[model samples]
Target: MALQISSDCISCGACEPECPNTAIYSGGTEFEYFGKKFEALASDIFYIVPEKCTECIGFHEESQCAAVCPVDACIPDPEFPEDRSQLLAKKVHLHGS
Candidate 1:
């Protein structure tokens, strides 16, 4: 499954750069994927794009955003219930195999 940022996020920007898939975006800012732009998921805090997220499966042993988050605001995104294999496939889809 993808990960989501909670209300506890401090807007410290710690998790932004840590995301291997670049799925984490700042509040109220636009995020682009494959030349397509999307609205911000959270207007007041950092949010992760479920479609672009892979929980760091292809780049790290653990979720780097969660690892570096000072407030532990990053948590599993229950809305998208994907397993390891699905996550890996998404990683490949985003960054190539």
Candidate 2:
């Protein structure tokens, strides 16, 4: 499943560098995906892009960003509960052959 950032985020920016897919970004920062850009959630907190997130399947044993987050701000996104296969598929789609 795609992981999400909760409001508990402290805007520490700790999870940003740990992300493999570059899915995590500073809040209020603009990010591009599928040829479209969206505004971030908060001007102070960090955020994650679900479409670009693959739960670190192809890159790590676990979500590195979540692992390194200090306050456990990163958590499973119930809105995007994907299984292992689905995550792997998303990884492939993001990187391509």
Candidate 3:
């Protein structure tokens, strides 16, 4: 499943750089990917894009953003449940390898 940013986020910006898929984004900051432009998150909180998230497969043993988040703000996205094989597929799609 795609990882998500929870309300517990302190907005410290720690997880942003750790994301390989660039799925983490600062609040109110626009980001473009997959040929689309997504409006920045409205809240002054960290956010994660489910479409771009791969649960760190093919990159790490676990989600790097979640691993480094000081407040434990990053968590599994319940809305987008995915298995390991699916995540691996996404990883290949993102990195083309």
- Tens-place lDDT per residue, model 3, 1-97, is 9988888889999899998899989999887687789798546898998878998888888899989999998988889989999988888887788
Top-TM-score candidate index:
1
Cand. 1 Cα-lDDT: 0.91
Looking at model 1, residue 50 earns an lDDT score of 92
Per-residue lDDT over 10-51 for candidate 1, one digit per residue giving the tens place of the 0 to 100 score: 999988888888899999999999989988888999899999
RMSD to the native, candidate 2?
Answer: 1.4
Candidate 1's C-alpha runs over 4 A off are none
Q: All predictions: root-mean-square deviation over Cα?
A: 0.7, 1.4, 1.2
Best by lDDT: 1
TM-score of 3: 0.92
How many residue pairs clash in all the candidates, one count each?
0, 0, 0
Error of 1 at 1 (Å): 0.8
TM-score of every model versus the real structure = 0.96, 0.90, 0.92
Instruction: Give the whole-model CA lDDT for all candidates, comma-separated.
Output: 0.91, 0.86, 0.87
Per-residue lDDT of candidate 2, residues 1-97 (tens digit): 8888988998888889888888998978998776788887567788889988999988899899889998998999999988999889988888883
